[model samples]
Target: MGLHQGPDPYDRQLCQGSLQRPGEDIHPPRPRGSGDRLRHPRRERGSVTLAVVRVRGIINVKNDIRDTLTMLGLGRVNHCVLIDETPQYMGMVRKVRDYVTYGPIDAETAALLLKERGRLEGRKPLDESIIKEMGEFKSFDDMGKAIAEGQLNWS
Candidate 1:
């Protein structure tokens, strides 16, 4: 064969520059700036409450995911936080989905989490007296309801 007459070094028949096989239909390139971006269901969330848990370790993780986790207050493994179902929070959760787990949290579960794991300054567990002192909600359950309804801030 001549210098450039043999089988092409990169076979277009075998590898059509994509994963599709020869017989499969290859989609055409999408037009630019068409505003047809893919949308996720979670991105259209409302003001509901969500529980995000960090299930994986930090080793070998990307810096962006780690920063998102830190912004969501999941600095350690098994650490969880209650966040509102807004677009920004949803985006952060989606960005770290591979290293975390998240879902809607009910008022009962929020109350339980507050009673068991919620801490105040100096590492004090949340209690009714503190609630009275704070002059916000009557009890842990009330506070939990406020939090679950996206009426209260975590910080």
Candidate 2:
């Protein structure tokens, strides 16, 4: 048996399709930015997120209640928005609780909702760049989670 058990990098370069081009060095370049780009940060298990879905019309709603709903991005009927359980948001929710329904949201459910309903004005799709420009986070799931935890206040 030889001292080296495995094939050398040069030997496998051809088989592995070497990415280096003419004049390029054999050493690969270091990755840019934080390595956490691919893998998201772990959250505590059983952490509950808050979600609100407008269940009634805004017609004839009291001025205070209507204003609260509008501020919450719930101007349209059946418009569902994810929020944290902070006292400020909770108070707003309380003001219009009669016209909406809310409950705890799990991480999986939040991801699904963000994929489907998350977006910017003018029907523009929400992506990593937009998320970064709007908030500190770069990942869509992170944005949703931060908002749910009241760490990133959209309102």
Candidate 3:
């Protein structure tokens, strides 16, 4: 139907939570006590995250699932994405969990990952000392510590 043709009935129903896609799960977010608790503790206190890594190839996967993986920055295997354990990101991870492995990321691991994978413009590897000299932080360890502690602005 055209946009000027009033709202589509199907669209209305979906927005009102009146329609359910067959075989789709749309329940409220599960309590923070169930599976993956250790790896995805509540982020209400401070910075912590769920580390999602694509573990399998996507051959023969559905288009939507593939898209979800891409959205999470895990379009390829061995790629990892650190997402805060918020409802929104958690929901995305749930969608493509079958093709990925996820767990809580600790501070030490976060620091190490930042050193190994975090890059600057032109694909130049980012070193903590460089950032420290520029005054973004006092030292590489401080930056890494902040990141590991989920104290940096991820946005």
Q: What is the TM-score of each candidate against the true structure?
A: 0.68, 0.53, 0.65
The residue-level lDDT of candidate 1 at 10 comes to: 50
Please estimate how well model 3 matches the true structure, expressed as its whole-model Cα lDDT: 0.75
lDDT of 2 by residue, 1-155 (tens): 67877866665666778554457668756778844455434432223357889999977878989889989989898888876665677789888989999986665666567667666788777667776786577676776666556465443
Residue 110 lDDT in candidate 2:
67
How many clashes does the backbone of model 2 have? 0
Candidate 2, superposed: residue stretches over 4 Å from native: 1-48, 127-155
**Local distance difference test, candidate 1:** 0.83
Off by over 4 Å in 1: 1-46
Task: Put down candidate 1 lDDT per residue, 1-155, tens digits, no spaces.
Answer: 46788776557656765555547787898767723365454434455688998999999988998898999999999999988887788889999999999887878998899999999989988888988899988888898888887778775
Minimal lDDT window, size 10, model 3 = 38-47
Candidate 2 vs candidate 3: the lDDT winner is 3
Give the 10-residue window scoring lowest on summed lDDT in candidate 1: 34-43
**Per TM-score, what order, best first?**
1, 3, 2
lDDT of each: 0.83, 0.71, 0.75
Please provide, for model 3 over 1-155, each residue's C-alpha lDDT reduced to its tens digit, 9 standing for 90 to 100.
55588756777678888687567797876657645554444455335666789999998999999999988888689998877766778788899989999987776777778778877778888786678776767755667667656677432
